[model samples]
Structures are given as C-alpha cells and as structure tokens.
Target: MIKSRRKLWLFVGLFFSVIILLTLLVAPSRNQLMSGSTFGVAPDGYAAWYEFMQERNAPIERWQKSFKTLQQNYSDNSITLLRVYGKSAQFAVSKTEREWVKKGNTLVNLAFQGRVTEAPFSTSHETDFGAVKIETTRRNTDSFKAILKDDFGAIIWQEKQSEGKIIYVTTPYLAANAYKLSPGNYDFLANLLESSGGNKILVDEYIHGYKDKETQEIEETSNVFAYLLNTTLLIILIQGLVIVLILIFVYNNTLEKKKI
Candidate 1:
C-alpha cells in the first residue's frame, strides 16, 4: 500500500511538470518586445532616410525601400499605413486625392482610409504638438503617435508644429548612439507636449509595462485516484469491525464441531 501511494504521487508530479512546460511554450509573450529602443545602429529606416535626404545629398532608392518594411508590420483591421515615396509633393498628384486640397501647406484628407466612418483629419480633435490630431484615443501602433509603436519598434514620425512640416524620421539612432559626433541631430527634437503641458516621453527606470505573465490555474479532477483514497481511508476506520466479525464466525464453527 505504501509503495502504491508513493508511485501514484510520483506519476502525478511528472504529469504536472509536463503540463507546465507545454503551457510556457504555447503561450504568447506577455511584454517581451520594446519600441523606440535602438538596435546596433539607427532605430529605423525612416530615421535613416531623413538623415540621408535632409541635405539632398545621401539619396538612394535602395535606402528608401527600408522604410516600406515599417508599414508591413501593422495589423490590417485596426491600422492603415500609407507610404508615399519620392518628393512629398507627388502625394497630391494621385486621382484619389482630387478631393483633397492644400490649405496653406497641410494636406487635407478628403477620403476615409476604410475605418468605421469616412473620417477626415479634424482640427477640433488635433492636439497642439503630439502624434496626430485625431480626437479618439485608439490603439495606433504605427509611426503616427509620439509613443513608439510596441511591435519590435519601428520608424519614428515627427510633426514640427511651428513649421507645419511632418518629418517621417529615422535619425534618432545616430543621435542615440555616438551622439557626441552628431550632437546636432537632437538639436531640433520633435515636440510631444500634452494638451495639459507635460512631457509625453515615458522613460521609466524599472520595467514599467512589463507585467508578469497571467497563468491560468488548473482545476483539480476528482478521478479514480481520489475515489481510491476515500475507499482506503474508510477501510482503515472499519478494519477492526471486519476482523472481529471473522473471529466470531471461526469461534462459532469450532464450538459446533466440538459439540458434534
């Protein structure tokens, strides 16, 4: 009995161990990836492109192709990322953009990008100097917002409010790494001021957003083993009664034989 109980417990432990290993491998990451963080060099292609083309000197089509990589990372249902290559003026030339007209300088949105509604850019919703001027606080993991898109990190887009020029940036990597050489890169940093007059950059020392993985508790099953344990315990309690009844029967049989 002791050996059997020990074996049962050993099997149970082994089964539980296997389940734990499988759960970890199958589960998605809790908060593994970080954005706006630098790689070995520049953070993204857009920043690199801006760095190259800022002086009209480091022009390369191959270099521009890297920026396209950023658009492919977006989820199709929630976000729609549109990239326009070459000079920014060519954006107005498309037939679909006929409804859109330049107001002083900013490109007015005439059509919707297939969302719930055909929403255009609203000045009412627009902030003083943030990601975009949209009123709703939706989860946009693209280069639109001042916050870094949390998918393995990507391009950094900047809108200069004073100049009314939106810079699709890729220059921060140089600024971040070996900043002493190109100290001027950060001289005109993108302004991400909140409507309440506070800095929006959330650079915390500890793992701020990295929360612990939510593990589901396994429900214990009252199976054959549990039933056996109950039966065994009941047997131990009534064991004396069973022994006494057997002895009484043997004693009665012996007395009858003696009388015969």
Candidate 2:
C-alpha cells in the first residue's frame, strides 16, 4: 500500500517533467516580441514612440547582458538600434565624414555620433537630392542589421555616415535598416507596448532608462534562466524530502504492524 501511493506521485511528476521538456524543444526560440519595419513613412507628421533611457541608477552591464541573452534565441537576423549616445557612437555605423542635406521641410540628419557609447543621435539635414533609391554600400555590423524589404528600384544615391551602416528601403518612416530590417542582417521585430507610466513599454519595447525608470517584476529573458535553475533545485530538494518522508512512513508502519 505504501509503495503504491509513492509510485503514483512519482509517475505524475515524471509525466509533467516530460511535458515541460517537450515544450522547451518546440516553442518559438526568441524573446523578440515584435517585427515590422518603420518603412515607407516619414517621421514628420507622425511622432515616433520609443523608450528613452535616462540616467537610470542601474548597472549598465546587467542591461547589456539582458540584451545579449535576448539576442541569442534569434533564429535569423534583424533588430532595431535606437542609437545610444549616437553622436560619438555613429562612428561604428556611418562610413563618411560629416555632411548635411535638406528635405522639403525636414532637415535630414545623416551624421554619425561615433562609437564611444551606446545611444541614438540625429543630424537632420538634406543635400542636393530629392527621391533617391538606396544602394547597399556596407553592412551594419555583427550587432546591427537592416530590416526593410529589398523592393526599391535601381540605386539613385547613398549617404555615408561615420558608422558602418545600410539604408532602409523606403521613407515616411524611421529608416528600416536603421531601426528594424536590413543593415546588419541581424533584424528582429519588437512588440513591447507602452503600459503604465507616461511612457510605458512591454517586452520588446526597449525603454530608454529601464534600470532607473522603474522596478521590473518580470524580466522574461533573465527570469527564464533563473527560474529554470531555481525550479530545478527545488525539484531535487523536494524529491529528497519526499523520499525521506516515505522511508520514515514505511519504517514506522512496519514497526507499528510488527508491534500489533
């Protein structure tokens, strides 16, 4: 009777463990929650939404690690780089020296912030050109990639920034290659949406000052590994306790029956 009960619970645990292992093998392997280029649209009439990281009193290394962990699950290439301290960091992206150009009313900035820090920058200028088709001159880098579709016609013109970069296909939107699809070839879509604060963001939405902005309860990327480890330890501990309890119960029962 004692052995029978123990076997029942053990079977249940083994069955659930198998289910968990199987699910891990089949789920979409990535933390990226969104995908879609900000192409064919201008950042003029519409105000673009992005999570701004201010002076957050958080460890920068922790944030970088979190970002890296998320990137590892990617099955392909593509990602949005909002630019961190882009003025100096632009050097990692743009290929040419500093220059300027003018749009109808918007001054298109095409200057590199140089790669000293991780941040975004803008030069908003326009040169002697109107509607131009972009040609691939270089790749974004191991860390960045373009996300726009290869649909634009013949090449018309290209702008070289200090950073090794690629051009997104269309306009009227944040250059896709700069934000989502093509440049570095490491492109992925983000779906994190704004939730509470005046500027709220979800999973994929990269917040500007995430570390300093607020206390996050659920860090999906980091939490997964942590949870896996903790849960595994708990399982082992519980199993040991369970087995000890069972042995004691059996011993006690036998002694009681023998005595009776």
| Candidate number with greatest TM-score | 1
* Per-model TM-score on C-alpha atoms: 0.24, 0.21
Candidate 2 lDDT tens digits, 49-167: 22121122111121222344434533223222332221121123221112111110101222221122221222122222222223233223322232322222211122323321233
Candidate lDDT values, in order = 0.30, 0.30
Cα displacement (Å) at residue 82, model 1: 22
Q: Model 2, clash count? A: 69
Summarize candidate 1's per-residue lDDT along 48-144 as a digit string, tens digits: 3235334443211211122123224322212112232211111222332221211111211111121222333221212233323222112223545
Off by over 4 Å in 2: 34-260
Q: Estimate the TM-score for candidate 1.
A: 0.24
